[model samples]
Target chain A: EPEVTQTPSHQVTQMGQEVILRCVPISNHLYFYWYRQILGQKVEFLVSFYNNEISEKSEIFDDQFSVERPDGSNFTLKIRSTKLEDSAMYFCASTKGVSGGSSYEQYFGPGTRLTVT
Target chain B: AQSVTQPDIHITVSEGASLELRCNYSYGATPYLFWYVQSPGQGLQLLLKYFSGDTLVQGIKGFEAEFKRSQSSFNLRKPSVHWSDAAEYFCAVEDRGSTLGRLYFGRGTQLTVWP
Candidate 1:
């Protein structure tokens, strides 16, 4: 099966440094999303992207977070500044949108483990 | 707002035993429901999804789920579970009314299989 792929499986960064998590969603997917899970916590939605614009974002997706589809296959999430609480597993997901019949299942990536010290 | 609830925080079953994980959701109308599993240190793996048609939906890894609109529930069941099946299961829902594809996930239930 064609799956979403994320780069830098694990990352360690300083508290105030900026970090970019990269993801290459399925080639044909039109909708992309980013989610975060603090250790032992629920998977929280960060933002959803479509047509190069953000469709929706959660309260947690504040000023520090931004997502960009710089290229056809790359969807990247950048955190302007990191905090200790920012450490978590960041996941990238994509789906074929409603146009692809009824199969709107969002395929998830292995995830980028972001560790802020 | 759409939300998912996974009642059992943890479940333990012996190898070869039947397994069922409970999931409940609160939504205005029937929404897109899905079950995802995550092994330790791994990303989420979709197990099954329910989106109309046959109330019972079958998915990967020999797992199936039945959608019950009356109870507002989608429960995942496996006839037999192996040690490799141990993982954290998350129940997610998408509110088609708003937020086209944003998924709201439950806290998740950790499944532990004993040999």
Candidate 2:
């Protein structure tokens, strides 16, 4: 079975530095998403990307966050000037952009743990 | 605003005992519910999902979840759980009315299995 894969499983960065988390979604998937889970917190949606554009974003997805599908398979999330609170496990997910059938199921990657000190 | 509520914070069960994890959601439109499991320091693994048709949906790893519209609940159940079943479980709902596939996940329930 094809699955989503993320690079740099663990990252440590300074608070003021920028970080980029990379993900390679399933080849045929059309919709991609980014979610984050702070320790002891719920997984919150950051943003969704489709057609190489952001479809929707949550309040937490502020100016510091941006997503890009630079290539056919590569989807990335960049955080500029990270804060200490930004440390968390970031997950990348993708699914076929369809309403009915099994396309709605989102396959998640192993996740990249971001730690800002 | 869509949200998922997993009431129980933690649960413990002996090996071979039956298991059930509760989940509730508040959504305006038809809800697409799913249950996912995550072991310690591991990624989320989809256990099952409920789309349209039947209320009772079967998923991988001998797990099943029932969607009760009246209660706004989608609870996951297992007939008999093994020690390996101990993990954190999350219930999520797909936001089909708004975004392409943005998911709202619950706080999650931690399951501890005794051998």
Candidate 3:
């Protein structure tokens, strides 16, 4: 089965440095999403992207965070200034939207583990 | 506020034993429920989901879940589990109000299957 794929399975960066996490969602999928899981914490939604624009974002997705679909296949999340608290496992997911009466089942990538020091 | 609760933090079951992972949700409207599994070094994988009609929903890998609206619960079950079934399981509820479906996930339950 076709699946979402994320690059740099593990990322380590300095506290003040910028970091970009890359994902290639399933081809033919229309809606993409970003979610993060702090160690021992619940997975939290970060942002959702559709039609090259953000549909919704959470408080955690503040000024430092931004998402881009630079190409037809790539979805990227960039953090301008990373903090210690920014360290977490980031997952990318995509789904065929409610359009055409498709069920909203999000297919997830293996995730990129971000470690800020 | 929409929230998902997985009451069990961890569970251990012998191979071939039946298993059930509990999940509860607090949502205002008709809720969209889902169960996901994460193996070590892997991302969350969809196990099953509950949208509407026929409270009992069957999913991949011999797993199933029941959505009980009255109880506000969507619990995952496996009649007989294998060692490979050991993984972290998460329960989530979809936000209906958002144009893009946003998911609220639980803390997750870690399953350890003994050989």
Candidate 4:
């Protein structure tokens, strides 16, 4: 089965540095999303991207965060300034449809572990 | 605002034993419920989802979930769990009609299958 793929399985960056996490969603998927899981914490939604624009975002996705679909296959999340609290497992997910249809299942990638020091 | 609650933090069961993980949600309207599993250092894997129609939904890995609208719960169950079933389970909910759909996940429950 086709699955979402993320690059840089592990990322280590210094505080105040910029970091970009990349993901390649399923080829046919329309809706893409980013979520993060802090160590020992629940997975939290960061942002959702569709049609090259942000559909929804959480408080955690503040000024420092931005998402881009630079190409047809790549979806990237950029953090302007990294902090110690920014260290977490970042996951990318994609689904064929938006809502109330046959395709509601969101497939997730293996995730990229971000470690800030 | 929508939220999910997974009451159990950790559960231990012997191999070949039955397992059930509880999940409850707080949403104003009809909610789309889902169950996902995550192994160590891996991403979330969908087990099953309840969008509409049947209350009972069967998923992969010998897992199933029952959606109870009255109780606002969707609990995952496995008839016979093996040692490989040890992992973290999460329950998520999304609004049925929301345009900008985003899943709200629970804290998750860690299952440990003893041999």
**Best candidate according to TM-score:** 3
Q: How many residue pairs clash in each candidate?
A: 0, 0, 0, 0
Most accurate candidate by lDDT: 3
Poorest stretch of ten by lDDT in candidate 1 chain B: B94-103
Question: lDDT of model 4 at residue A17?
Answer: 100
Q: Compared with the true structure, what per-residue lDDT tens digits does model 3 show for residues B1-115?
A: 9999999999999999999999999999989989999999777898988888889999999999999999999999999999999999999999989888899999999999999
In angstroms, give how far residue B49 of model 3 lies from its true place.
Answer: 0.8
Global lDDT of model 4? 0.92
**Candidate 1 regions off by >4 Å?**
A99-101
Mind giving the per-residue lDDT tens digits that candidate 2 earns over A1-117?
A: 788999889999999999999999999999999999998999999998899899999999999999999888899999999999999999999888575577567888989999999
Candidate 3 CAPRI grade: medium
Better of 3 and 4 by TM-score: 3
In candidate 1 the C-alpha lDDT for residue B92 amounts to 94
Put down candidate 4 lDDT per residue, B51-87, tens digits, no spaces: 8899999999999999999999999999999999999
Name the better of 2 and 3 by TM-score.
Answer: 3
Query: Can you write out model 3's per-residue Cα lDDT over A1-117, one digit (the tens) per residue?
Result: 898999899999999999999999999999999999999999999999999999999999999999999999999999999999999999999998682133668989999999999
Candidate models: Cα lDDT each? 0.90, 0.92, 0.94, 0.92
Instruction: Compose the digit string of candidate 4's lDDT tens values, residues A15-88.
Output: 99999999999999999999999998888999988899998888999999999999999999999999999999
Question: DockQ order of candidates, best first?
Answer: 3, 2, 4, 1
Which 10 successive residues of model 3 chain B have the least lDDT summed? B41-50
How does candidate 3 fare on TM-score? 0.97
What DockQ would you assign to candidate 2? 0.72
Model 3, residue A59: what's the lDDT?
A: 93
